[model samples]
Target: MTSSAIIQNIPCTLVTGFLGAGKTTIINQLLATKPADVRWALLINEFGRIGIDGALLKGRQNDVEKPNTIAIREVSGGCICCTSQLPLQIALTRLLSEHRPQRLIIEPTGLAHPHELVKQLSAPHWQTSLSMQSVITVLSGLQWQQEKYRSHEGFQAHVQAADVVIINRYEQLDATCQQDLLTWIGTLNAQASIIWAAPNDASSELTVAQLSMQLNQPSASISKQRATQSSQSRISLTLPNHLLTNMPNAGNSAAMTMDDEPPYRYHDEQQGMLLAGWRLPSHWMFAADELQQWLLQLPNWQRIKGVVHTSDGWQQLNFTPDSLTITTTSAQIDSRIEVILLANTDNSHINSKVSKNERQPLIDWDVYDHELMALLAK
Candidate 1:
């Protein structure tokens, strides 16, 4: 196909949400249920250096009846909306050129701002190259009730920029909570279609045609009262060096050390909080009990999610300030974990230490790394 034909025919869907909102789960479901004849390409972006989501999706692909038709690429360490833009463009162009997929799906890091991404995709250069479809934003009703996340600029931006808003984990909400969520979402995006789906529900399949139809309908008008809110509330927090650096023997051994001047940290700032990540080798298996104990003691982190190999099998870890849930999951290509911490602007401890060459001393990397290495050594 000619380049012009490829751009006009391909439909790209952007899936975005805040941390732990089940974005990966939804994407996996969509991929599993996709038509057997259609070729799909997925570009997943993560806030952490380790590509845990990509691994999980690949695992899901293995279970599908026809896995060969799908192609996956991962962009990690920073939000693609800013720091990872060039990488995204290069990867996307390559995926399109190589696969010639009928559809494209992009899952940006939870910390990303969707407006910037939409702007980039809709630029004049890509106008003839790609047709933008419905932008889906997934939300957790329980998290929506939390003042901390509800007030965050990045969360609000996701709501505002979406053409469709999905409320996952809807089964956990009561009638009043559901109504409150709908009301709040309506306030942010009047035009976007809203759908409620249970977490990991196989029936919730998103397709290119469905998204395209939704885009064609008239949307509700967004209120201008908060037009300036995003700009005013957005704060760009610098990611620590440890999160951007890659381990020397990444997937080869159970443990490894980092090198100096790994990848220069991406400086583009967004509207979200901070992230700290670790990439461990596939051979390292965590003792479930020990990992849980360590996670429980981490009171400073707001959200944590990752896939790790355990003595029993593969395990998935999902943690928040108030809860910790672990379940048996399939093994991934490697073990990786990322924790979302309080923003630098909000925490006095982080704010006081912000400097040009230094990262905020929110968490001690040396001690944390040592503890993780010791845990794996056990």
Candidate 2:
């Protein structure tokens, strides 16, 4: 493909899932097994203001063969399917125009509504240039059993939009639970191709061959929108670069330098969810064990993920109700963490998703900030 030639019919895949569903891990696996001759571009939309997934991906790429062939961009602070659609358009167009990649993979923030996004992506503008393939949604079978997830509209839509569904970590459950979960999924979308996979042991994910099998199925993404639209007033999104990938981060946020900048924090609330993210200066190091304990015990939240500089070295932390995994990492940059919690949370110290006057109390963010800083290495 010549640089001057127009790019069209790029094979595009969207990986949709709920928080902590291991979307990044699966993407990393796909990257490892991607065709050596094909140039692939990845766009990750993050729910938190401080972007960490892009950094995590770039960090792990050191182990990918011919990793230079991959192009990565991120849009953070809002879901790309809605509030940040403009940013998505800008980033997508630029990536295709500049990279002319043979394949495109988009990871929409887990909280986003897939039905609306599919409509927008299949709009007249992108219909001809990009060929939409399978929409893959990942979820643990345990999640399906929880009433909180089963009743959630975003979670349900993700399953409905998927051409292929991956029910990972289901082996951890007993036979009865697994059967009930599978039955529930069938009722939601009887047409989806379901694959059962073993739990990922932190370092690995669904094989490329398995992913390709799913992608081969043509997508029948939900075309009708169901969820209530967020306030159309656009939310600001930040696209940051913590990688030395030769490409610059888009001018999307205030944190200009990852190494030297002081800790930057941003908070956002949408769709009855509250998200917060932080970026600490690179020099700040924490006691790994202590930090892990503190993060795991965070008062009340749905999920927390971070890549940080620890006395034990750079570590990546992923925590959910069912599992907690921490592993060493090769990529280094400003240490950062992101947390997600339900909007009507009972945590008195945290803010709920409500208007200025209706908010419970001026959340004493200082308290949490102090708690985190206290774990810093002496």
Candidate 3:
């Protein structure tokens, strides 16, 4: 195809899922298997300001010398659907104009609503210029069984808007659980093609033909109005100063860079949720058993996700009100954790039960830090 033709009709695919559903894992697989002849651009969004996902995708330690074929842009501190929409558009436009990539892949923050993004791309201005491909939503098999996810409106919106639903970590489910998951997904989105696959294994099933599937429903008109409405929220956290002072440097100096900046304090929100996150040195390894025990006693956070350095190896942690899954995975840019909390709910009951003015803490950060220090000392 000629340059003008390619620029006018570049195929863009949107990959979305709830927090820690392995969307990045799928994206990485697709990139690894991409045709050598086809150039691609990647746009990643994160809820926190530190941009861990971007760093990981760009290959942090060698970011300066990374290849130029795959253009990457990250919009951090908020969802692309709301506060960062303008930035997203500018970055996307610039990426396309400069890189002239044949394919574009977008990984929106897990908390984002798909309808808003679809509406943006389907608008009159971009309708003729960009060819929107199948909107893929990844689901965790374990998370599907949880009532919290089943009842969430944002989660339902993602399912309803997707053209292809890929369920990751299905290997963890039994025959009965697998059947129930498929049944539930069908009830919510009968038009979408549902595929069962493991993380990093989706590329085999998500072939070019499968990704070319067209949307069954028209973009909803209400999404434009919803996009303008703000659901801003905030999370307040207190971490021990001693933990930051004593952490060691990462073992692999060439693999990643440990950020010295303090934890982010952003206030923007998405889907009625707010995030509080911390970036820890990669050398700060957690005791596996103690970490799991602490997670069990974690307070009422709506969602939690991070890549941690454990005594055994690197592990990915995914947590929700009803489920928590920890599986060994490769090391990321750093050891970091982000907790998402519901901001619009009343905390009167929690405060009264705990103390007259004390609110329910998300996690005992001080205790966690102390435990980590002791673990590293041994």
Provide TM-scores for the models: 0.75, 0.82, 0.67
Tens-digit per-residue lDDT, 1-378, candidate 3: 223443686777888898767676667666765665667888888877657656655654244554555878888777778665577777677777778887888898888877877777766556555667778888877677778778888778778777778777767778998888878888888777776654444456554334334222232332333345343333232234544445544223223322344322333445656565656556667787776665555445666766778887988776765457777777765676666766444432223234456343223334444443454423
lDDT of each: 0.65, 0.73, 0.64
What is the alpha-carbon lDDT of model 2 when measured against the actual structure?
0.73
Model 3 vs truth, CA RMSD? 7.0
- Per-residue lDDT tens digits of candidate 2, residues 141-202? 77776899899888898888888887776766898887787788788888788767556553
Q: Which is the better candidate, 1 or 2, if ranked by TM-score?
A: 2
Where does candidate 1 have its weakest 10-residue lDDT segment?
229-238
Over 4 Å off, model 2: 1-5, 60-67, 199-208, 222-260, 348-362
lDDT of 2 at 241: 33
In the range 1-378, model 1's lDDT, one tens digit per residue, is 545554554767788898777776667666665677888889988776656667776776666675666888888767777774688777787888877888788899888878787767765556566667678888887788789879888789899998788787667778998888888888987878887664454554454344335433322221121233211111112223353234334342322333412211111223435555665556566677787677656535667877877776788887865457788886666677766665444432333554686543433444555555555523
Candidate 1 residue spans exceeding 4 A from truth: 1-7, 59-65, 172-174, 198-201, 204-272, 320-333, 344-361
Candidates arranged by TM-score, highest first = 2, 1, 3
Residue 40 of model 3: what lDDT?
Answer: 84
